[model samples]
Target: MTQVHLLDSIFTRLVAWSIAVCTAVVLILGTLVGAKFEQLSVDMQEAAVNADMATLLDAYRDGGQASLASRIDERLNFRTPSGNAPHYLLVAADGRRVAGDLTDWPGIDTGEMTAIPLPDGSYVHARAVDLPAGQRLLVARESAMDEMVLNEIGIAFVIGGLFVVLAVGVAGRITAGRLSKRVGRINAAFKNPDERRLERLDRDRNAQDEIGELTRHSSEALQRLNRLVDAHRDTLDQIAHEMRTPLMHLDARLLRAIRTAPDDAAAQGLVDARGDIRTVIATLESLLDISHSEANRGDPRGLEPVDLSAMIENIADLYAGSAEETGHRFEVDIAPGVTVRGEEMQLTRLVTNLLDNAFKYTQSGGTVCVELVAEGPVLTVADTGPGVPVEDRDRIFERFIRAKGNHGASGGSGLGLALARAIARRHGLVLRLKPTLRGACFEVRPESTVDAG
Candidate 1:
């Protein structure tokens, strides 16, 4: 049985599309949020820097340049909520630092918010003012603390998004696996209809889901089909049985007529009539065998472990003299202990029918081969003669259909292979006509990869 896996169908598609959409949304939102945070951090730092510069200008007007320098030192000593003190730069007309942490004037236009890089890879968001008496003042906030906040935000969102995607994937797999197993159980018996397997399988058939409805419909349909087949088999079986006795009585009357014939021509005519009656009787028997086998397929009541090797060997022994008398070479390769559960009588008829077909077509000096392998209980019968045409291969197994050319057997009612296949299917086996380079070959195996019908 070919099982459906979660990764093969809808579940895989669901996971893949979810990951794609989730990643895209995360990337877009993460970029926007990070950019917005950086903008707000810069705006707040610029506001504080501008306020400090305004206060220093007031101090410059009140207590002169010395008062301004004093205010800058006081501000640098005080730290903010972020635990980083402000940066300051005071410059004279000669472009030299007056009293601040910065060594030189950073290249910036006055009265604008600017980020100046420090020697230690951090940045200070600053604002500068061209002050009174050709001097300058710059006030700044250390923005590296805001960068750290932004980094933590990015890391948290990445981890959280990936965790969510993984959780969803795991849930999808579990749900799909449960559904697949349930559906597989509901359909397994239907897939093996060749053996007429119709076990009572009901997996949530009353829950009103699509699978439940499907299960109910399949069960009902199979039941209806089974009833029709049973009725047909019963009618045909009864008809064959009723006709067989009168045919036998007619055969006895023909035999007596042949004995009392007044001339050889008259006796020969009666013999022909008897032979015709025998053909009809053989055809009816074949039909009954087919109906019986098909009706009882998959029923294990009368099955037993039969030594297939011994059975084929015995049948071959009986055909050996016939092959010699016709001057055809018969080859046999019987592997011992090839046992399988089946009706021995039906299996014997299957082998016999195949061998009979092989011998019926092969000319004198031709070859016939029989091989039995222990594994698979595989059996092959090949004959060196004109093989069946490609167009006729499938129909030859059909009841009452025969090929009129090449390998077609004379005087056949066209039910031998049909009966053989029915018997093979009844025992959970397959019988198929295998194509060969020269002549016809038939193989019987436990199962076939393709439909031989």
Candidate 2:
């Protein structure tokens, strides 16, 4: 099974989206709340500064500049009820500072609240008011408390957001694991649609989610498909069984007729007829074998561990004498210690059919080579005969198909390659015809290590 990364799963994506939306909402609300709080603090500060300004103006009116200056000095030294000390400045008509902490008059209209930049690179919120003699009364205070509260709120928001994202990520990972297991179960059940396996998914059928609907639908579909496939396989098996008896009887009668023929010409004709009947029977048998192999594709009973290297070597040795008599050079290169789990008879027939086709097609003095490689559990069979035509290559493995020029000379039943391919599939191997310059080259290799068992 291929490994799925956690970040690539749907669960991770959902959690990420949730975190993103939550972060945005938190940021927006934080900004709004901070702005409202800052506004309220500024309003309270403005009111307090205005009341102090009114008191200074009243002092100036009653006792002149000296009395107002004394009051300003007294208030500057004393902290207000809120424990925030206020800075005061009284400016004369010539724009010179008359008293208090401020060195000079600020650049602002009377009764306007504005930030005054101090020489120390800090600022104070100040409101100024006009006095009787064109003097200005400026009242200012530091804004440390408002700034501290806003900073705390910002820090809290960051910590809370991170905690939310972390929690979401952990939860997402757990959810993804559960979903992956369910998906794996569904896939395994689909591969081998047996009743007991399909019933396992019934536990989740009542769930009110998309996965539940999918499981229910898939179970139903698989059951219907398996039924149809079983019915079709049964029908084919019955037809193949019914035809074999009559064909055997006909073949026997033809053999008897050939033996009792009067002359060479008549005997030869009967012989040809018998050969034709035998070819038909061979084709029928090949068809039945292919059907049976496909019907039992994933059945464990059809498999067994076999020594592949030894099997190929034995088959090659059996065909070596036939190759010598026919004036062909046969070579076998069998690699050692190669084994596979498959039906021994089917594997043997796969190798035999390839050798038979190669030997039958090659002219005298042509060479046939069989090679087995340990890597990939690969098998190769090549012959120095006419290669398959490009147009016929794709269709050559199809049943009842033979290349244009191969019919009369080879006298093949046209089921050799097709049957070989079916056997290869039964063993979970790929049988591919490789392109060659002079002759046909066929390779058989297991698709994966799982197929080897």
Candidate 3:
């Protein structure tokens, strides 16, 4: 069974998408908030600079140029709440050196707040106004505190966003893992419908969730399918039983007619008819055997440790003489101590069917080999003949399906491989046709170590 991992399930993907969407929203909102904070900082600085400019203008109006220059000097040395002094520049009518720190007035419109680069390589927000007698009053303030505040807000957004991503991502992964485990439990319950163990499954079908609904619907469908399969198998068994009686009676009558025939030609005709009837009976018997094997696949009573190496050797010995008489080469490579748990009769038939198929299809003077390896309880039967065609390889194990151009001298009913596969499955084994360079190779082996001794 293929495992359903958390990362491979739909729940995990949905969680990831949700996290991505949330992260994007957080980033967008954080950016907007940060922008608003920066804007507020700029507004407060601009208002402070405009108020200082208004104070200098009032001083100039009351105390003339000299008094305004003196007021500028006083304010320049005064510290604000943030411990940064303001800057001032007073330029004369001829744009000469004024009575403040700046050498010349800035070329800015009256009352326009803009960044002014100072001689110390630092910038300040300033507002300029025309004074009496072509003098210019430029009042400015340092903006370092505003930059620091904006930087702090940006840092906080980054830290908060990262924390949210980590917390939500971990939570989502944990939730998805839990969901995957519940889904796996449902899958385990559905693996074997014949067991009818869905009702015994440990699931919360009453909870209002997608998983609960899925579990309920799956259980219902499996129950219905199982009921239909049981009914169909019962119908087939009844029909086969009903036909077996008539077939036996018909065979007895045919034998009596052959014995009482008046002429050799009439007797031969009766014999042929009996052969045809026997073929039909054989087909029906095979069908019943296949059905029985499938129905009893899970039955523990049919399982026993059988020496597969010994069984293959016995079959090879039985067919060796027939192969040599037909001018064919027969070989066996059986390894001792190769044992597997299965029905002895069915395992023997499985090996015999493979050998029969190999010997039937291979031409005279061809080679047939049967091999058993201790490892994996693996058995291989290979024949040097026309290999199965690529198109027919998939269907060759199906009942009544024969490979194209393979109707050899010994006629076949085409149930040999099908029965072999059925017996293999009933024994928890895998039987497959392997590709070969010159001919065909069929392999049979236990699917797991539990099936092998």
After superposition, which runs of candidate 2 have C-alpha atoms over 4 Å from their true positions? 1-7, 35-44, 51-55, 58-74, 77-85, 94-96, 106-111, 194-199, 253-270, 293-306, 406-408, 426-428, 446-453
Put down candidate 1 lDDT per residue, 273-370, tens digits, no spaces: 99999999998889889988988777565789999999999999999999999999999999998899899999999999999988888889999999
Candidate 3, 1-453: lDDT as tens digits: 467575778988988897898799889988899789878877987888888887877888898998888998887676675624588888888888677778766678876889888888888888888877888888888878777777887788888888888788889888887787777767766665545457644255775898888878877886776786678778888988799889889999999999999999999999999999999998998888788787756544447888887877887888988987999999889999888777899998888899888888899999999988888878899999888888999999999988887643357788989999998888878899987898899998776653443
Q: Which pairs of residues collide in model 3?
A: none
In order of lDDT, best first, we have 1, 2, 3
Alpha carbon lDDT at 112, candidate 2: 76
Best-performing candidate as measured by lDDT: 1
Say which candidate scores most in TM-score: 2
TM-score of 2: 0.84
**What lDDT does model 2 reach?**
0.82
Tell me the lDDT of model 2 at 173. Answer: 62
How well does candidate 2 match the true structure, expressed as C-alpha RMSD? 3.9
lDDT (CA) for every model shown? 0.83, 0.82, 0.82
Score residue 92 of candidate 2 by CA lDDT: 88
